[model samples]
Target: MQRVKPGDGRALKRFRWWQSLSRALFHLRLMDGDSGQTVYSVDVRHQQHSSSSGRVVAHLYLDGRHHAESTVPAVFPVQGGTVEVRASTVGLKRCHYVTAEGAEFQLVPDPASAEGRRARLDRSHPALSRCMGFLSGTVLVVGVVLLALQLAEQITRDPEGVAQYAGTLTSPIDLSGWANTVVGLCTVAASTERALRLRYNWLLDGAAG
Candidate 1:
């Protein structure tokens, strides 16, 4: 096998090539490349097989930032072909792709060897769930307060009898606004929790490096 130095480009351009291949999986990483920042990196994952109908795709990476991904489909007529990619930017460009080379390929997800991303997310923190509960409770409070205010307003509207409930008027929360706020808060909390879990897992797996 031979290596080639395919130098710098833009942020989303691909910069490497696999001239020919058959039945395999591969990984590519750019340790440092791009014009925006020297801290950027990239990783590409390609999986192909004899049974695969198309070429294995090499997901793109710019200065470590994930911008685009596409699979190279396996072609018919039973023949070999080239796979290529590029780097977008400049600075110590390491253009390399890793391939899983072996015979008797078997498709399977290794459990013991598999990284437990899902389980880790769930076991992350009680704070996330509790924050969700808090947003739900806010909805209840908003409803109760709005209902009480509406009732008082209705009672005071009676013409004949004197309206006894006299209090300073000021709306605490709008119904629609409260609902939207609650929903948004919950969504943000959930997303944040997920992001935190993912980052933590990556760090654990040494992928953050």
Candidate 2:
């Protein structure tokens, strides 16, 4: 555990390796209500339990002080906005702090986390990051297309009236079971990487999930 500052009331969270696949950390800063010049920080960690049905916890901090906490979907009232957090099996799908004026901003990860490292990479090497992002989107799109074709073939193979109207369908990229397993794993990795960047397309990424 790390403190936001020396003698600060709240314990700043440090990312752990074991939670790499199941945890997300985010931070937000705002003007303090009590002090005009002092700024406050809201730190939140979305940690999911190991079980499939386990719940996720969102811890909120204010000005390095423990302010409030809740489980998804969490809503914490703060200066000029409300901090909201949401989670999924893969990690956080939403962690935006929305202002009263309708402006929205996402809380980024702490500098020590894996997500933070990736964000730093984007800042330092934008072209590479963009390429990786595009690659992830492409992978998800391919997965979605393959899944749709397979589903269509499966549906048309046995159905009578539908098959008669649409004709029997066949997937163009048929592969062995081992090949499919490799593709599935690659798709999952792509989706997870996109999730780290907070980039998601419902049609493409959802199908991968």
Candidate 3:
């Protein structure tokens, strides 16, 4: 973790309405025993054009002031625990406060952001949220299956050398150009929805990414 230099008095910028789609802000409040409560915030800007290396950095804020900044996945020490932050191609994959005793708690998302809206939906309509989550997973699974079949068909198209080892294989489903494009769009949408909830699986979401 990179600490904010003492003399570097840069302040945390306010979250703008237009940046909701490309930015994430999360907050965690912890009780410091007899010392009372402490608040920590994690901020990430997904579209940082100035970052030549294309790495997303997470900024740590203490009680609304700039405290530290680090390239994710980052871990910033706090009063009682550490704030862990991670980002993905679409958005943040993880943002949690982990106590020294190993207890983990997800930080609260800023109400104005996309992630916050999705989380609000989950809380207000749990059944509907669950249905949406199921649909997203199903879509991703279908996409991966179709991709695997297409890859297999391509590999076995010219199986002259490998014919002796294994029989030629063919894809059961052959989608047209427009149909494949539709599927691709659906997969992207599904992945984006999952990202809003900070849900990611190396196999399912990774393929979409």
Candidate 4:
């Protein structure tokens, strides 16, 4: 990244709740270009949420100082590489700093954030993290299957020529209204939990969301 002098890293903005579960802050540390003794800091924020107005921005800092800012799908020039920040409908799916030499590393998460907590859990308890990951995936798979079956029923219920060829189909498992609501809620929770760990499967979590 271009070193923009010492004092530029001022007026750092505090985090906002609009960040939702999809927001994440990461830090990259590197040495300065001019003076080898100086250290530069890069901070990137990825925020994705349904509540947002569709604007995404990433901020860069030098020595804990604000240096520059750019919108998501952003690229920040750094010492030997660039930091790329990206987001998806539910959360960040990509946030990494890539070097000119092709080596890459993810930024460090802020200790206070939910993403940070999830990262900590992964580091401290790999087994538990794996179990939770598997559970989330299984939940999403169930949701996908149910949704597909329901859609199939809806498609075949109306008397149509296609139904004659395809054969009438009805969902074997029917859920009451309240049960449907509960399933919806559980699907949302499962997707959110998966997002916390930056785990996303387009067919599973995408459909669940």
lDDT of each: 0.32, 0.71, 0.84, 0.70
Q: Is candidate 1 or candidate 2 better by lDDT?
A: 2
Root-mean-square deviation of Cα positions for candidate 4 versus the true structure, in angstroms: 4.7
Q: What TM value does model 3 have? A: 0.90
The stretch of ten residues in a row with the least summed lDDT in candidate 1 is 73-82
| RMSD, every candidate, angstroms | 18.8, 5.4, 2.3, 4.7
TM-score of each: 0.23, 0.82, 0.90, 0.76
Better of 2 and 4 by lDDT: 2
Candidates arranged by lDDT, highest first: 3, 2, 4, 1
Candidate 1 per-residue lDDT over residues 1-209, each given as its tens digit: 12222324445433333411111212222233443333222233333212343433333333444434443321111011122332111110122322333122111211221112223333585576456445444544444455566666666665554354453344454457666566445543333333222221222111111
What are the per-residue Cα lDDT tens digits for candidate 3 across 1-209? Answer: 55322223367677778987789999988887876887888889987622644678778887778888777788888887788887888888899989999999899999888888899999999999999999999999999999988877777667575544676777779899999999999998999899899999989988888
Q: Which stretches of candidate 2 lie over 4 Å from their true place?
A: 1-12, 36-54, 64-66
**Backbone clashes, candidate 1:** 22
- Which candidate's lDDT is highest? 3
Instruction: Name the TM-score of candidate 4.
Output: 0.76
C-alpha RMSD (angstroms) for model 2: 5.4
lDDT of 2 by residue, 1-209 (tens): 12111323566555777666655767776666667543334333445332443556566765556666555666777678777776655556677889999999988776766677789999999999999998988888888888898899888997665698889998989978998888899888888888788766778777877
Kindly report which residue stretches of model 4 are placed more than 4 angstroms away from their true locations once superposed. 1-10, 13-22, 32-53
Q: Tens digit of lDDT per residue, candidate 4, span 1-209?
A: 23222335586555555554545666666666676643344344444222343556566776566877666666777778787766555666566779999997877766656777889999999999999988878877888998999999888877765587798798999999998888888888888787776667789877876
